[model samples]
Structures are given as structure tokens and as C-alpha cells.
Target chain A: MKIEEFSSDHLDVLKELMNIAMGNATASIADLLQAFGTMHIPHLTITDMDGLKSQINHTISADEKYYVTKQLFGGIIGGEFIFVMTDESAANLGHYLYDVSQPSDADIMDAVIELTNILSSTIISRLTEELNTKVQFFAPSTQIISGNHIIGQDETLNYHKIIIVSTEMEFQSHKISGYIFILARDETITRLRELIDQKLEELYA
Target chain B: MKFLVVDDSKLARLSLIKTLKEYEPTAECIEAENGAVAVELFKAESPRVVFLDLTMPVMDGYEALKLMMQIDSNAQVVVVSADIQTQAQVQVLALGAKLMVPKPINSDKMLGILQQLVF
Candidate 1:
């Protein structure tokens, strides 16, 4: 099914669920830093690679340096979760989590990976559970790179579409606002709709 | 005069409390981060009403609701979650939720529940 074929009801459900999942993720970051965080209303969309990149670039250019983290998950459906932030934001986060104002490069990377692992796993696992599907995720990996390096990967899943589920998270006491995303494969979109429809039947019908 | 709100998000819990305050200015609220803590709070405080989130770490709402039932079968639980799909609602109802309230809650819904729970 084409990405546009996804009904508004299905998209709404995904958005609502994503809001909570990402809220949980933001809470993890808060606990990591011992500070409160605020979650922006999530932006939910479905598009091809070019559109996805364009949407992201509308806010921050791809060429800008960003700390990118990635994790892969598989089960009834599969997808990649990507977290992005400016280099300065990453450093601020790392410093806060490490309790140092000027952490070394290695310390920053360690903070990034540990932070990403917690945030990514929490969001994806919460989302999958809410959707009533079991999923398994591998260890997360992080790098200080550009956003282009993230959406620029080639996939062998034979899927031409991705569900771009994203939100901006900001620390209440800190000046760090970053992006968190879940790019679900084409097949995963179909499966998600099926599960949602089944859920609709059980609740409304 | 007491309510228990269980959610992993501190922001969300605060939001719920804000809404609950509209109708229950004097009602006491106890917060829990997960189902395990929720069960413990239910034992310690015995709040008259509960607002439970279904997808939480440690133990999910389903298990929490079941255990709460075992402890106090009369507990009035309103399942609060973003996962309000029909299957989710049915499951929570089967697990013994009095009603299901989706996340991003507002005052009207909370006032309604407060009216029912209080008077």
C-alpha cells in the first residue's frame, strides 16, 4: 500500500501513541541528567527519502554537524530509530550527564551512546507494546556526524517508504532541544495499520 | 478524597494532576512511575480512584490492574494511555478498568470523572 493510503485515523493513532513513547524517552533523558524535560507535540508523517530529508532540512540543514545515534529493531515489524542534535547540544548534554562542563571527546561519545541507548530503547519498546506487537532491538551506536549521514543509508528491505515519527525534546532547565525519530520500513507500515484496524474493531465495533 | 496517578512521565503526571485539581481542589494525589510502584502505592494509600497508564516499564498496567484487583477489587481505575486502540480498551476493561482516558488529557474529562468519583 502506498504511504498516502494510510487513513487519517491510523495516522492519528500513531501520533498519539508516539507522543507518549517519546515522552517516556524524554523522561529518560531527564532522569539521566536529574532535571525535568518538556516534550513538544510530535510531528508524524509518511514519505520517501527525499521528502523526509527535505522536511528535516526545513528546520536544520543536513550539512550541520549533529550527534547521530542509530538502533535497529526486528519482530512482527522492523525499523530504525535515529536521534539527532547539534554538536553544541550534544556537548551540553554530555557534560550534564557526566557532571563536567568540559568533557573530553571520548567522554562525550560514551555519554552519547549511553543516552541514545536508553532513549531509543524506551521509545521503540513503548511504541511496539502500545501497538500490541513484540519487537527486539540491537545495541545502539552513536557518532558525531551530520544528519545526511543518517537518512543517507541504503536499505535492503525492499521497502520504498518510511514512517517518519518524530518530536523535539527540550530540557526544562537546560538549553538543549533535540530531535528523536522512528523510521519504520514499508512493510512495518502495513502491519501497523492491520494491528490498528484490529484494535478499532475490538473497541468500537 | 484521594487519587493515584500512575505514569512514567513526570510531565504527564503533572498534567493529570492539573486537570484533577479543577474539580478536586482538596483531593490528595499520590504519583507512581510504574506499575510496581503503583501497586505499592495502592497498598500504602488506598486511593479511591486510580488513573493508570498501560505501557509502563517494570510492570505494565495490565499486571498492575490485576494485582490491584486482588488487593482491593473495589478500586476504581480509569485506564489512561495514548494506546486507546479498541483492543487496548477491551484489554484494560477485561483487566478491570472502569473507563479509558486517552493521553493529552484536558479539564472537561477529568471534571466528569471527578463528579462521578466524588458525588
Candidate 2:
């Protein structure tokens, strides 16, 4: 779907949905670590592969170390849910999760997986639920890598036309922050636009 | 009458409950956060109508729908989800769900279903 096709009202719905989703994520994470957190209003973009790369690179600088986790979900619609965190932020988050000043290597890995699970369930699940559709996530996988290559390495993903939904997540107590991206495939993006249009019509008409 | 509403998100459940109350004011509403807990409540309460969410942890909606049907073949289960693909609609219907409503719930449609299916 063309991003232009979505009116301000449609984008409002998406932002509201993301706000609710990430709000839950922040609250749950806060509960787990006994820390305060903030979730920004999500931003959306309709772009191509090159544009995606440009956007991602801007979000993560070249020298930054990152933890990237991605999971595929499908049912009425299908897409990828990706979570990105810088090295410093990831370390802070890990410390909070493990409740240790110096976490073991295994502790770091486990914390990442647990955090991913909670977020994938909380954020993406809420987004889909608000859309009135169900999505089942396939297995989630992660990689620890430097920032410059995050988007460039994934050639398997269809990037012809992607709908990108992103939000900033911050844990104030731990001084940790991260980004969450939900990439709706072109087909799913088209369907989402159609559904939003339908909803708008019902509301106005 | 009693109704069981299952969704993992607290906000979603509350939204669903609001719409449900508008339609069936007298029905007592019960909530569950996941499919597994939903099944337990379904068995324990034998609610007149069940509004189910499809994507959840512990037990997803498909498994919960199947288990609820097994518990009572005549279960009046409604599938409310964001994934409203034709295949999903057919699959859930085949498994005994009465209807599937697409998300951001359409109040008029939901009320119509309450009149048709619940009564």
C-alpha cells in the first residue's frame, strides 16, 4: 500500500495502537526490574530497501554494538518484528535483568531471550489485537553484531515495499534504551491499509 | 447469562468487555489473560457465549477453541482477532466457532452477532 493512501486519521490509529502496546512493554519491563521506563509514540514509514537501510543506519551508528532479534509472524497478515539495542544499553538491560553488576556470558544471552519474548508478546500482540486480527509468531532468533550491518545483512526479507513501525523504549533506572521495529510485508501492508480505510469509512459514513 | 472473554492484553479485554456490555447488558462478564486460563474458566463456568482471542501465550486461540469445543460440542464460541484471512475464518469455523470478527471491533456487527448467536 502506498503510504500516501493512509490519511492522518489512519496514522493516528496506528500510533494509538503502538502507544498502548509499548506502554505495556514498558510497564512489564519496569515490573520485572523494579525500574521506571518510557515508551515513545511509534513512527511509521513506507519505503524501499535502500530507504530502510538509510533509516536503520541513521538509528544505529556504524561503530555501535547491538543486539538484534527478529521473529516472523503470520495468520491474517505476516511480517517481521525486530528489536534493536545498542551495546551500552544492552549491557545495562542485562545487568537489570540478571540483578548483577557483572553478568556472565550465559546470563547476558538468557536475559536477551527473555526480554525478546516478553516484548514480542506484549508489543506485537497488542498491535495485532487492536487490528482485530490474530498473528502467530514463529521462533524468534537473535544476533549480536555491530550496527552498520543490521539491515544490510538480511537479504532474505522482501524489501520491495515495506511498512516500517518503530518506537523508542527506555528504562530510566537502568539507563538503558532500545528500538523496536515491526516490518509489515508489502501484501500485509496493503491489507492493513484496506482495513484501516474500511474502518474510517464506517466511522465517517 | 454469563460470557467468557479471553485476550492476553488487559486493554484489549477491557475494550471487548465494553462492547459486549453495550450489546448484552445483563450478561455477567468474566475475563482471562491467555488461552490456557481461558479454557479453565470455560470449563468451570460453562458460560453461555465465549469471545476468544486468537494470539496468546501459554495456549493460543486455536488450541483453546478446540479444547472448548471438546468440552461442549455445542459451545457458542466467537473468534475475534486481527488476522481475518479467509483461511483463518474457515479453519476456526470448521473447528466449531460460530463467527469471526475482524479487529478494531465493529460495534454494529458485534451487536448483530450477539442478537443472532447469543440469543
Please provide, for model 2 over B1-119, each residue's C-alpha lDDT reduced to its tens digit, 9 standing for 90 to 100.
Answer: 89898876565566677777777787799999889999999999999989897766688888999999999999999988754345567789999999988665657867877887866
Candidate 2 stretches with Cα past 4 Å from truth are: A1-4, A153-159, B1-119
Q: Pick the candidate with the highest TM-score.
A: 1
Candidate 1 segments whose C-alpha is farther than 4 A from its true place: A1-3, A153-159, B1-117
**Model 2's DockQ score:** 0.02
Best-performing candidate as measured by DockQ: 1
Task: For candidate 1, give the DockQ.
Answer: 0.07
| Cα lDDT listed for each candidate | 0.78, 0.77
TM-score of chain A of 2: 0.90
Per-residue lDDT for A93-202 in model 2, tens only?
Answer: 77878889988766776787778778888887887776778889888877888877777675755547888889787776587778888887677877787766665564
As a whole number from 0 to 100, the lDDT of residue A160 in candidate 2 is 78
What DockQ does every candidate get? 0.07, 0.02
The whole-model C-alpha lDDT of candidate 2 against the native structure comes to: 0.77
What is the per-residue lDDT of model 1 for residues B10-114, given as tens digits with 9 covering 90 to 100?
656766887787677897999998999999999999999999987666888889999999999888999887653455567788888888877767888887776
